[model samples]
Target: MADIGAAIATRMDVLPITRTHRRATVAVGLGLFFEFYEVFLAGVLSSVLVKEFALSKAALPPLLASTFVGMFLGALLLGRLADRFGRRGAFLLNLGFYSVFSLLGAFSPNAVMLLVTRFFAGLGLGAEPPLADTYLTDLLPARHRGRFIALAYTLAFCGVPVVGFLAKGITEGKILGIPGWRWMFVLGALGAVVVFALRRGLPESPRWLQAVGRTEEADRVVAAFEAEAGITEQKPAAAAPVNEPAVPPRALLRPPYRRRTGMMVVFHLLQTFGYYGFGTLVPLVLTAKGYPVSQSLLFTAVTYLGYPLGSALSLPVVERFERKFLVIGTGLAMAVFGIAFGYSGSMALVLVFGFLYTATSNVFSNAFHIYQAEIFPTSVRSTAASGTYSLSRLATAAMPFVLVPLLEGAGPNWLFVTVAAAMVVVAVDVAALGPRTTGRALEAVNTDGAPVTAPERAPRQ
Candidate 1:
């Protein structure tokens, strides 16, 4: 069965680019579009909530941390749905779960109620990016996998600038008599609802189906893909299958995987301070630096242009270099730009340094997401990725508590310096331990050099 799974991967890896592939990428990418919208909305909205609702210092952290706390639990507890139930089902379930809570969050009468709903929404939102990564990784061929993943994210990351600009234009005012922040949540929820309906058209992951011994279903899905790609040639039949060894949930804690897991765990924990730290805190950081709320929102919106631009720029080169090196190189760049962003007192320098940091961060994001999805075996891909990703969520949830005071007491300069230091650690962690993953099949990367096929066991007498 494992050999059959490997063969299915080979078939997928060789198919030419076709509409079927593009359709899958778009379907998965749309979910991510709203997922990012929901995630970044907290930052934009928080800037307004403090003024709109007259929130005090004591009341703000809970509101800021609420959704991230939910995300931590969701990623930690629910990420295995893809590994256990199948990717297509998990896609529908998560989007639907989050959208409802996001809608409710829009109607909350108070900050406390809003955060509660945001937390529930976070539960579903947390699983989305990991699921998108694993699903796309399974579907695309090795030759252009990095490019497609970066492409999908290019579409998805448009949400960041959209939210940034939306907040800038409306967050301090109203639309149809409703508060702009509430409108932002409603917009994200509605977009997610649309993506949920579209995702139903997706096919289950053939690699996952084969890994779980559903070879017939896997064959049908791959056959449909081949037909869509107009391939007439077929590989020779696979040999008789052997039983696949069970991958325990604890498998990530053992030897070959253990070292990889440790590196990822450390990377994720520290990386949060740089990624989400600067990302979600930008508005507040500018505000704390004595800028008005309006100016802060404007800067945030302009800076967010880097996300989609970076993802688009990465498409041409995503597969050209080792992904680990991209991760390391970009992390160092982020540290440099982030520190410069903090020191710039002039608006032009602020926008320039901020845009540079945001752009490089997206490239870093693209490289690491593609890297992590390819490193783990299909049997535990979502679980391991989610488990490691949850730590980042956990750290992000704690950022308000930690970063808020640092911003207040030490000022934006030291705060961004702290962000720079975290990125330095991330660069070190990856440089020391991360593996090369560009242009390699998931199976080969996970198994060290080539696909592993266990010998067949004799039937019971």
Candidate 2:
């Protein structure tokens, strides 16, 4: 009898995008919308709390850093959880965990409690990106993976500006007499619950099912999708064996994977400081330059409009471009724009540069988010991706601690200099060591299994 991995590859590799696939992608992305929305809330929320409670400089970094502390721990510890557990279950767990804690955060009595709640909530946020990315990477068709991944992230990233507008509305007027800042968390919590319920209908990955010896279940999943799409069952690819051996997380550092792992770790650490460094400081940056709170927030919202638009712009080109080079080029653009924004003395210059920074970074964001999860095989994919990804969260956690001081001591220009230099290193590392992954199967690119490159013409059942 043919084995499960071959069956899965045959089923998944060339299947046309079905309604179910679109729904699955959207379901995953919707939950992510809240996660990212909450992440960006730190910027607006900090402003709200500082004004309302007179939050101190010392306290601010800790509060901000606390989320990443929880996220780092989550990513470090939970990396293997999804691998050990099922992807669908683990993802729902992450979302449910975050939803509950995010709601609880709204009722926090003080910044300490708020910090604690955000930290707890972050435990889920940290685990999610890798889990979601890995989940999509494993499930998506290799031929159209680039475009689909970009679309999913584009939908998720729409949350950035959506949250920006929400914050602006809440700050302007309270709903139910609750503060706008608190409502931000409440909305995020509510949205997540809805997404979780919608995702309950999603099928488990056939690859994951096969990995855990649930080959029959894997077959059923493939059959179900095929039935829904009116696709005839085809013979499994007569190539790779059903299952590859699982690697311990440490083994990822052994040979072929070691260089990629190192590259990812360095990329995450460097980019976090640059991306989150500027992201978390937008409101603060504006206020420091003497803009009124209303004007600053308005400008912030205007600038953030680039987030979704940039991702959308990347959609047409996502599949066309080599992912590594896309990441490098956009990252460099992000740095250049970021550096210019920092040195900008006038409002017009600030908004212009900020818009460029947000747009380019997002294009970079969608590309690398797909790339990182693409390089590894299924067995230890989440563990390796999450473990390496956690470093970025840790670096982001550390950014407030590093950046607040730099901005206070050396001012915006020097602060951005630090950020740009870090981004430059990330670009150089990827350009130097990144693998060629555009238009290749995950198995072929990873070098662990037989190459199952899709033919130019679509295979008929």
Candidate 3:
């Protein structure tokens, strides 16, 4: 077992993340950014769409909810496809699906058409995050996995500012006689073109190769990575031990991993309620509070800065602490700060609270992505993450329609208070049940009764 672990780690470590890998990372990152851009643009363009289509506030939720419904189906369906087919094949097909639908979204003539297009676009978007997370995690060395994952998320969020800035600029100044709001979908489609081009050069993940019984192809891919990194002597592949029982997904519901998955799902559920509630409804909330469009966009931009800022500050801590503890601590902090945010009237206080809330919440966000993917075996990693992540999306999709009514009836403070309380519950669950996965190998962190060692650090490149 020790030798097997070492061999896997060595294989992961020796593979150089060369220029090609870097480009692959960038392509995948850009793909994620565009996915987010499509989702978030609705927040920026809500009022415009509402007015242009002569729709009421009640109409907004269903439009947004449709996307997540599609995403749920996509993740479940496409995730299984990735598992059965291959990562590269699944990724290319999904990207093409997204690109075509996004472009068509720009041509939607009515609310119904737009909603349908967005839903399909979301299906394509849904597959990318978990797929990208799985692909990137498999490609990088274990020691650098956390940082690389952080970088991917950071770059993925670059779309927040880009969407905000573009929406602000174009909406404020109409371009090419086209409605600025429509350009959001148009530009998102254009971005997909870049993703498509770069993806053509990406090699298949070596880990995926090994899983599908293509051992020679896996060796060559790993060897290429090793050669790029200048590591000549390769570690011998581990012989399969006799009578090793196949670990089923049901095992994840047993001892160590059961607790881990439950904690993660609960944490994500609460966080999604808060995050999607606040994030998706920002423009509507701001408009209700009497902020102008430009100011709303500006404030949204300022608030989202917290995501990247939080990611940067939390990277060091992520490496130091057990992922479960980090999630609990950050989640508790977010709950406290979120309440303060709900009560504050001053704009400066709101922005301050927003920044702090985003920072703390994202620490949990970044950690969980790495933690969840690590907890499962490679055979079902994408399935687990995608399926689990889709639950958060489902929660988020429901929030706008369900929570918005409560906010309107009871007021913003009550709405936030409810969300904060949920966060508190999540924090407790995670603290009690979450497993330690700070420095662990992906293969050894299984729920099955495999006697595993503490994950070792990968050699620095």
Question: Which candidate should be chosen as best, given lDDT against the real structure?
Answer: 1
TM-score of each: 0.95, 0.95, 0.91
The sequence of per-residue lDDT tens digits that candidate 3 reaches over residues 144-229 is 67777777777777777677777777876567887787788888888888888888888887776666566677777776776776
lDDT per residue for candidate 1 within 1-461, as digits (tens), equals 56666667777776767687798889878888888888888898886788777899988988889889999888876778889989888888888889999999889898888989999999988888888889988888777789998988999999999999999888777889998888988888899889988888888998889877798899899888888766666644233322223376698899788888999999999999998999899998888878898899999999999999988878877888889999999999999999999999999998999999989999999999888888788889889888899899999989999999999999999999999999999999999988777876666677744543322211111
Select the stronger candidate by lDDT from 1 and 3. Answer: 1
Clash number for every model? 0, 0, 0
Candidate 2: tens digits of C-alpha lDDT, residues 347-458: 9998899998998888998899899998887878888889999999999888888888888888888888888898889999999888878777776777655454642323
Better of 2 and 3 by TM-score: 2
Which portions of model 2 show Cα errors greater than 4 Å? Answer: 1-3, 235-245, 448-452, 455-461
Q: How many residue pairs in model 3 have overlapping backbones?
A: 0
Instruction: Name the weakest run of 10 consecutive residues (lDDT summed) in model 2.
Output: 450-459
